[model samples]
Target: MQKKSCGFFSRASELQRAPFINLPLHTGRAPAYLVRRMIRMSHAMSKVIIDEYGQVEFLRRLSDPLWFQAFGCVLGFDWHSSGVTTVVSGVLKQALKLDVHGISIAGGKGKKSTSAKTDILLLAENFGLSSAKIDSLLYANRMAAKVDTAAVQDGYSLYHHVILFDKCGNWAVVQQGMNAENGMARRYHWFSDNVQNFVREPHTGIISEKKNPCALDMTAAQSQENQKVCVDLAKSDTNNLKSSVYRLAARDTLDRWLGGDMVVDVVNTSGYEMPRRLDWALFKRIYDVQPGSYEELLSIPGVGGATVRALSLIAELIYGAKASWSDPVKYSFAHGGKDGVPYPIARKVYDESIRYLYGAIEGAEIEREERTDALKKLASFTTRMFPGQ
Candidate 1:
């Protein structure tokens, strides 16, 4: 099969916008009746996708934010709610059978998210993956979470995490973070094939309605020099780093610390603050470990957002290596049809979509060639509708 191009996987232009999907934080569990229908619809849709495109391609589609959002809508979830991420993932987790689909999902919302390692090991053993391959998958899972939570210091804090993988170890990640202040959620997507370096612009796409004016994006390509400096500082003496922090904290004014006459916005100055509470013991441990790269330094246990921010500031202020402070969000959407901007979700239409897809898959089981051609036409139509996806 020929591979199709997806814009999210391309690294040619950093300025090009990624596909967008907004997720507003809404409290409430999806009704049991709605969830049951969603499970059935998700199972049918996933079956056809895996059967037609294979497990790897299915993983690729999940890594695309636009496709994932559409999938959530097709499953009858509120398109603009943060629940779309968690609900869709939860539905897929229950719907996809490893023995049937040759794929498995691990981790989930809140406390369930912490059990990913255990789930991965169990599922990998079932898949007969080698010890080394399983270990690599585990590392990938950990690093994906770490990169989003620390390296990219957007205000959102991750609350939901799930990794979808196939028998061959190809994987996709859909994790979401919440901004408690604004009550919005941002989602991060990752595909194994698209990532070459975990520390540099590694996300396939990041989706959010609100973009922070001054996010500390350490994973940005422009931050490469700063990343190198950060690694060097981590390997350097803790005393020198502490002295730099002290000097930064002792400054009387923001302009003096910034070394300019420029006025600083009081609200956004939180991003620029030199963290007064530095973990000197953690720094000592980091110094002992002597991580050769920023990624390695980040993978070290206990390196949270605070540590990453402090390091970036120190690198910029004292070492003359400036990190990028641009928010990494690619695009935004304010409303969803389900939210009654245009119209509410029509149950009859939604049910018809599910029935049509389910019936088509059942028909394909009997008339594979004709169904395949029809599916090709559908794909062509979708390409025309969503070009560059």
Candidate 2:
């Protein structure tokens, strides 16, 4: 089912209003000329946004998937291109110098991501944030990446991650992952303000060009039951969970447990057959720690996708607590829909977004026509996304 959704781009119902990572595929680097221009325009834009709305508002808009996409488009990048994420983040890193803007972007594509902790430390020192606060922010960055990469088994391996924050400690994350087979990339966004539970519904938005039907979304609200069961199973004796995995390894036992009618869907969606054996060693370690919640279980090292999936299945099949198999795709933009499928667009909210972007361009060093053209592009993007009444 995940393969079906991922193999092609498809529209989901607009009413669901769930967050999803934007997944789009376009390779190669943006031309040097374009990149340089983006950096200049983005820098000007950031200054205006921060000046008008304050720093927190700037971070909030960046955390928004639709606003982020539109910002990239306004800077002249392809609207649906995967490079939008990498280029926008990269340009921001270069353009938004902390001393000048009071906000800093740490980390980058691939190997650069490893420097996030170091960068955060330096920024923390400059900002005069205490060790506790800095450590907390650092932990937030690590856990956010870990949950997306390992907890969500959506077949995308994260290669690009960046965290943007102000000196006041507010932060947002924009990260992208690539699926080797399909050559598609999915981007995930996180805002510290919006994160209630890191393990469940923690994204500001996820805008993927395609949805994965069988994607194991343990964070889905419907999976709340399964999450509880998984925590219990983790705390229970390792031998019990190991036995269930052993049962899954045997075709006869699996068939008996699933029954004839239920076998196909379970096998296809769960990948029950592929993970032939359990990592009992890791399970023993988990057993020792006995995590009190699903979030903690996910945070533990070695608690990768296979381990999580297996636990979910056992919880569902044996304990009758099922995880959500439904796709959590919501096609929403910055202002939302005027008709109110997800939510009605407020005039004040919409105007404020435009005001900031417009102000940024107006204040930029660009010529009169460039500023006018930039505003026109933003207007067109808004109209196309949400037509007026």
Candidate 3:
């Protein structure tokens, strides 16, 4: 994913307020018969949403992590498994015909995900998109992946990425990352209409049940100073940065530097350790480029999580500009219930989504029995979500 700057929406506050939902990793392919039904259902529902609300609104809804999860449930996928992201996205890619829906999906699971740029090129030809607009779309796709994988170091290695976009250039991203050790997956969401900055708290939502207490979140607002310091360090003499890194590494622990006699145990040191070695070649390239902003620094071809971590540590210990170690996950597990365990459900909005989805299912051209089964599943999902409601 090559990087380029693109205009993003300036609704930071609204994006920050969006809800997140989790899905645990599950093995095995979804049955073929079930996938057929999901495709049909997704097509019908997507048509209804686009027809009634326009393509932009459809993108917005898909960007909502909660609604996306609920949509997967309504379409008969496992409501709490990681497959919801890949399956639902794959179904939509097949379901939404560009000529009919004015929307297209690019990228997918595993190896398929790497062809997003090629897919976007072919798909956008039908829409008569300009080269610049197409580049922006690609930039959005790459930067979202970069931010999630590099800027937010939560230990989830991304494997699935898809970008849903309309002829108008608006887009949303649904990508899933897995932590092989824990057998859990995290989903990241991005909407072109909800993001103003790519580097600072730009996600529409992030869904994960497990929160890494020591995750490095350079995207946090609190990390703004550290980001600046990182850029400055990257622009400064590489030898000076190297010396600082050596000094920090020479010390057995950063306990004194961090301003406390805190225990220098394995767990704590693991979070703050200077990388055993820095990529001097990459640093030399960064120096030559002299990136003016953290976003640009991240956009550099070779910069990844470990490099970002090393820079963040140097920024903190040497410059005293602390990077936030807090996990950016806003909610955990299922969407919040009525009593607000993780957070209160926005009932009116939730009901509106349910009503529209139900109406679409009722209006769909599928067989009566299939329709009945889908509605039953939707109802079962609702009951599980809010018991006794």
Clashes of each: 0, 10, 0
Q: Which ranges in model 2 have alpha carbons more than 4 Å from their true place?
A: 1-23, 248-274, 334-349, 387-389
lDDT of 3 by residue, 119-235 (tens): 999988989999999999989999998998889988899999999999989999999999999888988988897788899888877777666768889999999999999999999
Model 2 scores what on Cα lDDT?
Answer: 0.75
User: Model 3: what TM-score?
Assistant: 0.88
- Evaluate model 1: give its lDDT: 0.74
Residues 133-225 of candidate 1: C-alpha lDDT, one tens digit per residue: 899899999999999988888889999999999888999999999999988999999999988999988887788776677888998988999
Q: Rank the candidates by TM-score, best first.
A: 3, 2, 1
Report the poorest 10 consecutive residues by lDDT, candidate 3.
Answer: 1-10
Measured with C-alpha atoms, the lDDT of residue 372 in candidate 1 is: 57
Give Cα-based local distance difference scores for all models.
Answer: 0.74, 0.75, 0.79
Off by over 4 Å in 1: 1-21, 254-271, 332-389
Compared with the true structure, the alpha-carbon lDDT of candidate 3 equals 0.79
- What TM-score does each of the candidates earn? 0.79, 0.85, 0.88
Pairs in steric clash, model 3 = none
